[model samples]
Target chain A: MLQGNCEILKREQLTETIFDVTVSAPEMAAKAKAGQFAQIRAEGFFLRRPISICEIDKAAGTLRFVFEVRGGGTEALSRLAVGEKMDLIAPLGNGFTLLPQGEVIVIGGGIGVPPMLGVALSYHGRAKAILGFRSRSAVILESDFIRTGQMPVVCTDDGSYGKAGVVTNALVEQIALRRPDLIAACGPEPMLRAVIEVARKEGIPCEVSLEQRMACGVGACLVCACRTVKNGEEHLRHVCKDGPVFPAEEVLL
Target chain B: MNRLAVTVAGVTFRNPVITASGACGFGREYNHFYPLSRLGGISVKGMTLRPQEGNLPPRVAETPAGMLNSVGLQNPGVDAFLQDELPWLEKQDTRIIANVAGHTVEDCEEIARRIEGSAVDMIELNISCPNVKQGGAAFGTSCMAAAEVTAAVRRYTTKPLMVKLSPNVTSITEIARAVEAAGADAVSLINTLLGMRIDLRTRRPILRNNVGGLSGPAVFPIAVRMVWQVANAVKIPVVGMGGIATWQDAVEMMMAGASAVQVGAAAFSDPMAPVKIVDGLAEYCADQGIESISEIVGSVHPWE
Candidate 1:
């Protein structure tokens, strides 16, 4: 990924809270993967904020990142004009592992949904996507998911639209009906933990992406390590190294 | 054509641009951006005898053109590195320098002894880490303590020793001489200067640690000055770091007496900085008609 400042081409609110931002990084788009992320430096900020790559069109030479305005950096990103340039360090961190021989079930909650969208688009297997939001205004990417032909199952807590329940309720029903061979999830910790527990009961292999407050996203600071039980051994693995994506059974949610 | 190389205290580096310790974290995450073997070498994060929790929130703050960090020597401890990181780092073609630190002289020695026969190319005694409550910054500020710890580790292994000195010391030359007399093979300076930032609204320190080590472009001039002073005083090869983000900065350090320059805070800005620096340095030397990069090492003494 190139380091110099590149201009922002577009910034639009997909949902009330979630915004889709596209930046000018031709090289990053060429090798961009669904699970990889970019560390973005807001013009006045010293440290860059890590945002997952939501979409990439290599031929078009464009990269897009979806972020929920959670903090100063992201809020700053949402306020920027189209012609403004931003310092972006892209295509970072390990991404989703492509598994063969199974229908893929993609699950997402809140802001964790964007990164998984890229994965669903890339998967060659039969893909079923389950999306969750607190209410209708918080929901995003429904049309995009449909455009991918996955026809994502939408769940809202308030019953403003779609299924009136947590995404897991929809997940359980999907598991019973479709019995997808593999599962992937990215969301709040509790939701991922629930998904992991569900995937385990069905004996289906699953992967979960995590988010931690990180400093040096490159693993130097040792700031964002998650404890995982692997091979019956408990270990602290760097989220940026071992993964932002880990097998559901292995991570200590 | 020769792919210019540097040999520091008998250890060979394919080039002189190395990823500084505490910046590149054993070369794993950065490997995603470029091949880990592309750099001259990588100095792993500082390892202590036991796992350290480091500092609290707001550990890093921006100061003018620099940044301050009180990360408090947070590491996975020596055992974890030996088990988890060392084997993987050893497999890479680049040189691995183990940066060792502790709360006491014996602790430093114990950790160094543990890595005696491992794949580590050298030992960089981190006497400059300012985040810990004990032994880290304390030892580097006093020549006696610096010598005590340097000699303690020197007795255990014959591996090359590179003592990292703090700029907070009253006389850098005295500390450099102390480590040199204690048998250090080389010296690296100047570790971040001790400084703090104020959060005007809260009317307190911006960093939770109250004080942090300052680094980045703001400290480049100071680091070059200290490297020049220490390099002249001890006769030991010096590795200079602090705000080195570009080829020009690397050249400035080498001319100021650094045999090799370390890239720290700059890595926070660009993960592939070390690789870009390695490539850029070569092009710069080629354009300058310099046969060997070593020719520019210490070339700034006359200017001073």
Candidate 2:
């Protein structure tokens, strides 16, 4: 990966907690794929922040990344202006697998919504979305789905908007209506667990993107690890290596 | 444009700037940032006979200009390294130096034998990991234990072997001499010093293990003095490292009697620091009209 400074082309508040940022990384954007990530820096920060590749326009040499201001690096990222330059290490980790056409359900919660947006744009055939947020203010990327003409089901904890429940409830309702052949989810640990449980019960194939505190962002440090059950034995796999995505059943909740 | 080439134990490195063990992690991560072929060499993470899960969380903590880590030598077993990591490493242009650690003599022997025919160019016996409770720092603290482990590995591999010494010991000279006399091709020192940080609010140690190895800019002077002492005591070549962040620090190590320097803790501050140090050293040499960097090695202490 080449580290370079990219001028921010645009920045918009998708929600109170999340921001959709587009930067100009010609080399990165030219090569970036749907499932990969970028290690971005807020200029003076010591550590680089990892953000998923939300979208890319190879010809225009612009990359879109969605991030929430949870930590210091992201908070710093939110303060940058349109023309400000940011150091970014892109296409750093493995991306999502492009599945063949099948009945698919893309599930996301809060910040996890961005990773699935690209997949939704690529895969054809019957595709539905189950989005979860704490309230209306936390929900994001709904318009992108609506623009794509895929009517999505949304869940908010306080009934502030959409269905008044967790995304899992929305998922169960959707599955009851018609089971999807494949289920994909990314969100907080609890929501992912619920989604996995629902998918397992319905006998639908499912995958979940995991998050762990990481240093090095590569497989070497052994810092960002998640326990997984493989061959009937549990072992630690680097979240940056074995996956940011893994079959839901294989991961140890 | 410069001769970054360095020779240790008759083996030539394309450049003197090898990626320090535990920092570069088999060289794959850095490969993402730059070309792996650009490095002089890469010391793989400390390995063992069997896979280790290593210490608990909060394994690392930041201190003033330095950081403490009790990673506890987390590594996949020798078998896993051989089956999975080795073949991948062999493809790289950089030299592979396996940093091995163990809880016992037999463990070291098994790991050495396992790596005998592998593509690795040398073995760095990591007897100096202070964070572990078992045989690591214990062997490094005592000359007798240092000699014993070195001899065990020497019996297995004819490849050049470097004994990594600990700084926690009272006399680093004694440990250096012991490893040299025990058939070590070279001796590298001083590993991160044993240290701990206090969390005032919790009124307890910040690290989950309560202690960790201190590395980075804070440990440079200590490492330089230890390298000087050890170099004087042993005939074997010395690879010195502590908080080497720039070319000047590297030059200090070389002048202090280090044949080559390893950049640790500094890598966390800047992933490309080693490359910059290598470039800076070349520029420094060129301006001084020095033909080879080896000319400046041990050039300090003219009065002595």
Candidate 3:
């Protein structure tokens, strides 16, 4: 990981509460992989906010991250403008590991869809994406996923979007149509847990990205620890360092 | 350049800024951001006799200007450190302080014995960790227990022994004096104050451990007061910590009677805080026209 000043190349409001920002950080853009995150420092906030890498433009030396205005820290971050310089610790935590030859199925929920954009792009049209949102208005990055993946499915809870119900409903239908060799997902804890269950029943290998309230984006403070079972024993693993990503079966969630 | 060197128990440090235990891990994670040698010292994550997985999830809660953590001293055990982490740490041009924690005197003694003759510059007995179920804060709250643990570890090692004292005690100076009398080379205080936070929406405690150690800007003044009291009562050197974030806070800590200061929770928010403090101290000394940074140690003069 590296710490440097990133200049905002572009900033846009994806939704009322969500923002999509592209920043010029060559070093980070070069080194960052899919599912990794950056710790962003905002003006007047003591803590650096951790946001996942939504997409990357290596040729242009820029990276895009989507964030929601959760509280004061993110509120300050959303106010950043073009040409503004921000301090960031980038390419942190373990990223998703890609498999060689397989029909990959990607599942994302709400803000989780952003990280999957990078994953879909990495798979080079061999991946199918299932995105879930609360409603049509909360949808984000649907066109980006479609541009990268094959047969991108967008679902909403209130049936105001492409498909009704949840991403899992689409995931179950997709599994029956074509059995994917692997599954990669990022979303809320409950959604991830449901995705893992389907992957396990279908015998498809799955990896998940977890979210935790972290103090230090590095492995140090152990503030972002999550419980996992490994070798028949349960232990605490740091979400910032050991993972924001882990094999779905290994994580208790 | 202004002289920022500090010698605690005969171990010389390039500066007076040390990364407090539990905040920096074993120095590998932070090393990716900057060189570890840029700071004066690194008190590694608190270690135990055997590997510990620490507490359950939801172990941290952010409060106003600070945070509460109940990590429970999770570490890879002493043998793992000696085999895996020590070689890399020894190469760094900074003082290495092994922060040891245990449940009993034997546990503390065994950890010290294992680390003896290793590359560590000092052994910081973590007698004040407040998050554990046993042996940590229990020893720190009592003068006798603190001294006993210090003497137990002191018997097994020739390295400089620094007892980390907790702020939860009734009298911090009394505990400092007790550890000093027990042949401790130096003392570090105050470990995070015992605290807890509740989630209003859930109507439940935020941390899984319920009460964790509180550190950050909120605990700065309390740490300075305890450091001054302990420094006045003990002849051995004092390493002050708790809520130290900036160079001004470091200088304030030194003036209040700390030979060195450890940046703890603040490092979580800003990874460069300790290194910045080191640079900030030199600038302050140069601007003040002070030849030696030691001139500020215990220089606070209270009106009679």
Per-residue lDDT of B213-252 in model 1, one digit per residue for the tens?
A: 8887889998988888888897889999988988889989
True contacts kept of each: 0.24, 0.17, 0.70
Which of the predicted structures, 1 or 3, would earn the higher DockQ when compared with the native?
3
How many steric clashes between backbone atoms does each model show?
A: 0, 2, 0
lDDT of 1 at A180: 82
Question: Over the stretch A1-253, how does candidate 2's per-residue lDDT look in tens digits?
Answer: 5677899999998766688889998898777666668767654444456788787778889888899998566989998879998777677666666677667888888888887786666664367888888898888888887754488888899999999989888888888888788888888989998889988888889988887655556666665557788889877676766788888878988
Give every collision pair in model 2: A1-B32, A35-A95
Q: Please give me the DockQ of candidate 2 compared with the native complex.
A: 0.25
lDDT (10s digit) by residue, model 1, range A120-229? 88774378899999898888888888866668999998999799988889999999998987788999988998898889998988998887655577667664657778
Residue pairs of candidate 3 with colliding backbone atoms: none
What's the DockQ for every one of the candidates? 0.22, 0.25, 0.72
Worst 10 residues of 2 chain A by lDDT: A41-50
Docking quality category of candidate 1 according to DockQ thresholds: incorrect
Best by lDDT: 3
In terms of lDDT, the poorest run of 10 residues in model 1 chain B is B56-65
- Those runs of model 2 whose alpha carbons end farther than 4 Å from true positions after fitting are A13-17, A42-45, A124-126, B32-35, B55-70, B83-91, B117-119, B131-133, B169-174, B193-222, B264-271, B301-304
Interface RMSD of candidate 1, in Å, is 3.7
Better of 2 and 3 by lDDT: 3
